[model samples]
Target: MKRPITTLFMLMSIDGKITSGDSDELDSDKDWKTIVGVKEGIGQYYDLEQCTDLWSLNSGRVMEKVGMNDKAVAQFKSPVSFVIIDNKPHLNEKGILHLCSWLKQLVIVTTNKNHPAYAMNLDNLSILYQEKFDGEKLLDELASNYKVDRLTIQSGGSMNGYFLRHKCFDYLDIVIAPLLVGGKDTTSLIDGESITSSNQLHLLSSCRLIEAQTLENSFVRLRYEVLK
Candidate 1:
């Protein structure tokens, strides 16, 4: 049960939708700006520069949503290590290489044992293993090997749901924008296998709201601590 202090940081619409649709863009530019502003606030509040790990489940979609093009990617610099969770290692070698070029370290989490034996052999690349995407095991390895105390999970919905279902997340930092993108295909804040009746989250039992604030941009930031 040993794991790092994991936090889920996400931006969602008023209706709790994470993405507009299949597209890798938010509802509007203002929403995107609001997310960035909240992230900056988080950085200041938490002194995030000292954090060693930045995690994401969907790298391509996240990069596109954040408007990280090739030029932006090239100039991107961070002291924190980048950890990507991909069960199948679906990302192309070129893209992985590109990110490894800029990041301090690029760690790929995959269930596939042969992932590291592939063609790309970047300097700061490391491969970690987890069977069937075990969230707790992954975090334990991160905490023990990488010394990632405050790990951030900035990702799409399914991964968020995975961590929540596994009860591996300690903090949930959500920024709710003042807009709603309603569509059947729209992704929600947590999208994964349905939790059974026995395992559903109960208020004040599994989690508790610690902070709630309304930003100047009409966005509401809510922080919740998962009680173990």
Candidate 2:
């Protein structure tokens, strides 16, 4: 099965943590604008005017944390479709449907075959399935059905770790912030359990740095290609 090229884009602290604390709130300091360069670099690297689809794991919480409420999401005018992975129906179906009616589409990827809300007819609501939420199969369906060639993954640690564990992503784009928040409960870019010697990601064999640059705000941007 053919799959769309996947890029995991994230902002991390100097110590490799995704969030400063246990909260999902992102670092919204003025210096955060440095992320624009990373977005531009992705567009240039992929030769895309704009990304085809925006993917998220538990995107509902992300939107809420980022100050985008149901009303705000409904007002979004971007052409890019939104794809969310919600194996347990963590998001509100009504809000998702409302947002989808105003956008290109809203796709919910779930393993639950008997989701009652999805069973009801909802306009512009697409439900894609996998028995156990296989990341590769979800990507294949996105490519085959939605024609998504370049998909951007904007997610927290758990989702990022899922793709990394499965080797589903192709590229990783990271923005290193200058701030450091040290906490044992803090989240990192990857949230899975510690890997043993056999399953560790060996940089030399698994990935290669393709781009590195300092942005105007003193943030460092790094891009790496996952070696296949």
Candidate 3:
């Protein structure tokens, strides 16, 4: 069965600048603890317990660059699986093995593995790999593996843009916090093409939360629907 693509986005500022008139760059850390907690809340609100067979969609390059490297495994979701897009021929075996075991539902989208590196590194993990490179096909394969009718996009930036541009995302949730980041090289919580096609989004809900006890501040959570 085919499932509708759902995307969720959460953004936090260094000084709770959700309505700041000026555009400020993001800071390092990106307030991950709060972000993870919000994601957990979303999973609970969505009652993922009834749909435990769902898998998360993400980019393999970003996963290798950040997900595996993070020392404190952010508590985002409970026992959720993932479907990642990675077609690199030189990917290491150790990384794939680690991710496959960690994620509940793991699938890799890649082209033919005919390279020397792939041949040598292919192992038990290779069994979960697929050969489709497009976003639509990737989602279909994920639905086949898990009975997913929705998707939540945890950003690394580029992957988010690709999915949104393809109109594969059907929902967006933004968590705004109080902070100002004047950093030069940092990135905002969300960035993408101007969405040339007229797409209407309806507001699903809004809530507020005290994000961090250590920091002692509140944040606004806004959920938007990418009209079907």
Candidate 4:
């Protein structure tokens, strides 16, 4: 049915350098602050406390952190139903089982059921085992079951790549922080092959949300439409 999704990205480094080529410099507090501020701002814009059909797609790593971190867990507990995607489905149970308590309908997307961790949480969580991972099909299932019209994609790199490659994103909300982390092996904000000139995104709008309250020190929010 071709459901539209909004992809939200929190990227580190002002120069678009998540990590440098050389694996030396790591851990930048300034960058982290910017990221947190942006999160807070986003939280304000949307009613996260209310239970709605809003669906969130996260990477495996994010799922683990969000499941454990009190703040993260609470954020998911609000209105949005979370769908965490991982190539290895087992990791979802092994790491982030507790946060499942917060989620109304916790969905895990994985390729196969090959790990011992997968067996433990069959009763507690909803598992969607796919022979092949297809984002479009996943969306169809979500809209059917959860009644979600608008979807958001939170990055964990490879998951972002899958959606990007499939041209599944409708809008992109990029929060760029003003800091740099210089290292080669550092995690990327998103993982995707170079989208060619033909696939470049078109700028829809760009605006700054001035941070009057909380950690946000006035961040720039850019919106783009993926030119599919």
Candidate 5:
């Protein structure tokens, strides 16, 4: 398959939990702001994220959680393009407009025919609708249509698992926080259906560690090359 080089990039806790808790009210972005130990190092994560791939892949739920729909006034222009997968139509029309204001390009991939992005006519916006979502096909489109050479995956845990299972992810860049937020139902770095049989053992993603750097305030930055 012809596709862009993809990297799974995220900031997670020591125990691999992506969110602070199961509830939307308790996300790492908000909860870590006031948390003592993790708070000090949170800036490092954002700083590193800003330096990642220009082609960013995210989820609508996370965007909504970050108040994407509430921001009416558009922000300053950015060179980075945002590719969001929103099957549930999580983002409203205003959110699509808000992204168009800041992003150099905004691509909305959805299974929903009534996505708010389809209603708009923006110069920077592109919509990709599919009856059934295909992880490999999405990467192919990003590489061919958008000319995205490198895509940074910042979506939810389920999306990460999709990429992993489909062999679409090439690298991993994770910043581990000092905290350890644990709950059986809480989201993690990779959350999806577990392999049911021994025949699927090869589906597990194994990687070779490229580097492990100890950042400030007990934060650790780990990079790995995913073995295909």
Candidate 6:
């Protein structure tokens, strides 16, 4: 498949937890900022994120958890073209409009026919209706049709798992926080169906460490090439 060079970019805990908890209310953006030891170096993650690929992918669940649904913003513009995968229609019409106004382009990949994005008739907004979610095909379409060269995967763990399982991920860039959040139900970096047989081991991806840099306040930046 012809697709863009994809990078899995994220900020995760030392224990690999993406969220502070499993619930929608618990998010790394909110919870980590409140903690003393973890909050000190948290700004570094956002600072680094500003330099990532202009084309970014995120799940609607992640945006909703970050309160984009109720977020009030002034009329502004951004260079980033955002791709949101939403099936539950997590974002409302207002939120979709907000994103459309802010981003260079807002592409919504959804299975929901009644998705709020479909109602709005905006030039920046494009709805890619899918009968079933296919991460690999999505990337190919983004590259072929949308002219996306480098795509940054900033979606939730479930979407990350889909990319990982499909071997759609090309690179991994992570800012590992100093703290360790331990919870069996908490969201991890890779969450989905686990391999039960030896034949399924091919789904596992091995990383070739490209660089490991230590940032201030105990935060670490790890970059890896997904060894294909």
TM-score against native, each model: 0.76, 0.76, 0.59, 0.66, 0.98, 0.98
Kindly indicate the candidate among 1 and 4 with the higher lDDT.
Answer: 1
Q: After superposition, how far is residue 98 of candidate 5 from its true place, in Å?
A: 0.6
lDDT of 6 at 18: 91
Give each model's whole-structure lDDT.
0.66, 0.66, 0.50, 0.55, 0.90, 0.91
Residues 138-157, model 5: lDDT tens digits? 88889899889999999999
TM-score of 1: 0.76
- 1-228: candidate 2 lDDT, tens digit per residue: 398888887767678876547765544322233455433333232333233245433455564555334453455555657787765555665566556656677787777776534765766678877777678777888889988887888776777777777777888887776666678788787776667776565522277999997764456778899887
Q: Which residue segments of model 6 deviate by more than 4 Å?
A: none
Q: Which stretches of candidate 2 lie over 4 Å from their true place?
A: 24-58, 67-73, 113-120, 199-205
lDDT of 4 by residue, 1-228 (tens): 546455554444545543333232332322353454444443423332232236777766554443343333343444446787766532544355554656666677778667334676544467677888888888888778767777777655556666666667766655555455555555565565655675464422233433322224454445566655
Model 1 clash tally, residue pairs:
0
**With candidate 1 superimposed using the best TM-score fit, by how many Å does residue 21's alpha carbon deviate from the native?**
1.4
Clash counts for the predictions, in order: 0, 0, 8, 1, 0, 0
Once fitted onto the true fold, the runs of candidate 5 whose alpha carbons sit more than 4 angstroms away are none
- Candidate 1 per-residue lDDT, tens place, 102-196, comes to 77887887777766325677778887766677778878887789777767787677777777777777888877766667886677887777756
| Candidate 5 displacement at residue 75 in angstroms | 3.4
Cα lDDT tens digits for candidate 3, 21-140: 332222222234345433333333233223423556655555554535333433343376666666664235555555655656555566656522244342323333455557776677
Model 4 compared with the native: what TM-score?
0.66
Better of 3 and 4 by lDDT: 4
Q: Candidate 5 has what TM-score? A: 0.98
